[model samples]
Target: MFRFFLLSIVCLITIPGFAQFPESKPEDEPFLDIGVALRFNYNLSTWKEDQLERGGDFGFDIFRINVLAAYKGIKLNAEYRHYAEGFGGGMLKQGWFQYDFSEASQIQVGLNQVPFGIQQYNSNNWFFNMTYYVGFEDDHDMGIKYIRDTGRWKWQAAYYKSAEDLVFSAAEGSPDRYSYDILGRNKENNQLDFKVVRRLGDSLAHELGISTQGGLLYNLDTEENGTRYAGAIHYEYKTGHSLWNIKLQAMFYRINPEYAPGNNLNFVEMGAYGANYNVANKGEIYTAGIAYHIPLETRLLQGITLYNNYGYYNKRVSGFENSHMNVLGALWTAGPMYIYTDAAFGYNQPWLGPEWENAFTAGTPGDTDWHMRFNINLGYYF
Candidate 1:
């Protein structure tokens, strides 16, 4: 199934004359735009413990296919993704249609991203970090949302299903009664989002956003329901030669643990703060990163990008005390192409036992505890 969809997209982009599609002019063209991007990365590694060893050559990954089209009163947009190794497998990230009813109001319907967090609104290329924060998964639900613009103050409202999956049930009384069949249901997970922004002065601006969602769930053994909520606030400042932005976000959920049957979890949460600065013509970018695990009460540098960067992560947290990491790399961009390289060394500090001494390492086996990565990306706009 995934393979078929992947092939269809390839054909759509590669067929002869596909590029000749009507191009709108600046003066006479409607407000529509389309673009695509391709990105790839490779890595080398060395490890201190058997548990941390895994490396080899990876294939090019199709980052995304972004499409934007809008007419006088209607708008359409979509994005898709393709993974490495799965040449014929891909997934639809977004597909939506929107309508503008005057300069102040608009409505959108289809499978689209939920407008709940600052990261969702900021373009991927615009962020200082290339990776998403913990708990910030990229999954969109089918739904509808409305937007209204009132000068510097804009607002949005959204409602969507929480889950989009099929459950299998056993057929009643038959030799193959134990066999299960797939069933689909529209769980009532819904969300509401609101936002407002205003410029404080010539070089300062602030924005506030709030979002909430709730819905039903089906437990494997029995039917169940639950609710989840998330909220975020952001502040941005830009001057002739400096820029600063900060955001705080949180999420809460009430549910049951699949493995720990009969154990109902009340809350699980995570938070992160990041800031970056570009010194006027210093020929480099500087960034600071930090994240807190409410569930584990642990914190770390996360990363820093000066010119270029290299960093490490625990990948997973169990009874681990302190995870190790290293950062060494830089980035350069020209025209529509960007290139970057980084290497790092990581050591795991266990809360108990022999500390796993150098539990994780990268780059060279003994020379330097770091692994090197090279990334090259090219994108075009129309």
Candidate 2:
């Protein structure tokens, strides 16, 4: 099955006229383009009583299909994702339309990916892999957003519905009602982001960004009727052949007493797969990282690049320990394809660990541990 899909993808790229859209010869005519990517991975560790579990493998980890059409002042865009799991497992990730009001402003409406950060929209950008806060989740709720870009300033605001029911309260022995007050409201949650970039010289530039989200409601096994708020700042600078970026974010939340009384346990489960304990309280996290890139000038790999990054996160409320991550990688562009590889190391202090022994230990679930992953991908743009 994997081989057949792989061959089909290769043929689509090699076969001319596969992109059946008409060419855009006139400025007023609508235009269309397509993009595809194929990825694979092999695990090095196996699950066992004394070793980490392995045996997870995938081919064409992601198959993306994009369509863009524009005519007059209206624009339409759609994207689909097909995983190796099969056709039924595929999903319509993004479909949206936008109307241009002027050179500096536009309004977009549809079921589209929210634009909360640069990482949220462009995870495939070469620089994204080098950062710890890449916002890898592409979750999109039905919504609309407005964006304004003028000179050095840019901003965007969006409102979306919660993807699931809002739980008001819960505990190991008790249950509560699921709130549906905002079920039909388009603005169940709101997000705002802004940034300003300035050029200091021919070889130097800088940018600052602010992002915030609120009005999120969630009901869990321990907490009921919870609310979440977050704020983040990002800074970047570029000089010569090197670039640098840093990000800091913090969050506060409220939950029913059945969980805890403060903000510590909100959104800290590592993408939705962590154990739930009703220790309600407030929590704050501070994270920062830096990345450097070097471009090779050789004729065979002129676009080759190297990157490295390290990030640290601290939580103040949930008994959760502080964690850190380090990553290094490289990319080489070969004609219409690019080759890339990355390795990451992470460590954390468990609540029971000594001050100097916070680094994660092997052979324990939810314990501090380290892992390394590598990937080789082929991507094309039209």
Candidate 3:
């Protein structure tokens, strides 16, 4: 049987996909498939500031457990992951129950992906674009989502009660997660999202979409609610003959938060990957990326993709230094085995910069410098 997201790079910003990968649909009888994946990586990071560590290079990254079940029009999907110490021990990436309205429409209820920025992902590299850090790209929450796909257009609408509740709390969500979310002294609630994309062409497809999202940030300290909103315009060009994909996106976001006395409104705490850090209250992001899929069919090598993603964050805060990131990488797929090789460069990015506490919050603006990391990750699935 063909796997839904098995080893697919499009699952990077993984969701219990919405009947998008391949032409998958619920079969006549009850069916279940369970798979496990092991991943390891080698990295030479500048931020480590250690020659020996950089030279050592090789380490275990993470492992994943995934499940898919379907009966008639009802479907189920879930994935859990375990990472090395200090990053996040283990977490549920996503879990959702889906109901297909027809071949053209469906709904997902449970912990589902929030429709924003770009579909699946905006970047093809191992490390996604900078937007993933600030809870814009590939984010998930506790919600219900409706999706409709026409030959030429796709529409998505969702309402999230809040971010994923790790410890069953309403106040704060743990940061040990694959996708970013709002947390800390405030909680994200009553969030709504709408997105529509238009696809033009067959062999050479031009896709454009607009997305808008808004929510209330409930402050536990003051027992009141604040507001945050974002809007984005995204475009992509894919050519079957050339096997080239081009993507571009522009976004503007602002968080009008009401905090307790003495709290700064310029930046707020956003959490992910087992940590919480300051994120700028307002910013505009511009991103571009390109990928070429090489159709080389072989026993050992099934596919190859070369890509580069670049993002620039223009902070609205005065005198705050802007952020820049570029990831150039190649992906190789062979059956259930996949590999990625990347060289990532950044300035003021938490994952790439020296200071991690306030990189996105722009709290420590001038203290950051250029950093780079060379990484190779390999994954095998059963």
Q: How much is the lDDT of residue 211 in candidate 1?
A: 45
Off by over 4 Å in 3: 1-28, 51-54, 202-204, 239-242, 363-367
Cα deviation at 101, candidate 2, in Å, is 1.5
Each model's TM-score? 0.55, 0.63, 0.91
| Alpha-carbon deviation at 33 in model 3, angstroms | 1.9
Q: In terms of lDDT, which candidate is stronger, 1 or 2? A: 2
Look at candidate 3 and tell me the lDDT of residue 354: 74
lDDT of 1 by residue, 8-44 (tens): 1111110111111132323224544445666665544
lDDT to native, each model: 0.37, 0.42, 0.82
Model 3 lDDT per residue over 263-286, tens place: 887888888778888888899999
User: Which residue pairs come into collision in candidate 3?
Assistant: 175-274, 279-361, 280-361
Q: Tell me the spans in candidate 1 whose CA falls farther than 4 Å from its real position.
A: 1-33, 45-58, 85-88, 121-139, 163-188, 195-199, 238-331, 340-382
Q: Rank the models by TM-score, top first.
A: 3, 2, 1
Candidate 2 global lDDT: 0.42
Show where candidate 2 strays beyond 4 Å.
1-28, 43-58, 86-88, 113-139, 163-204, 218-225, 238-300, 348-367, 378-382
Winning candidate number (lDDT): 3
Residue-level lDDT tens digits of model 2 in 56-148: 443555556766666666777676756555322465656778877877788878775554433342222222321223122244545787888
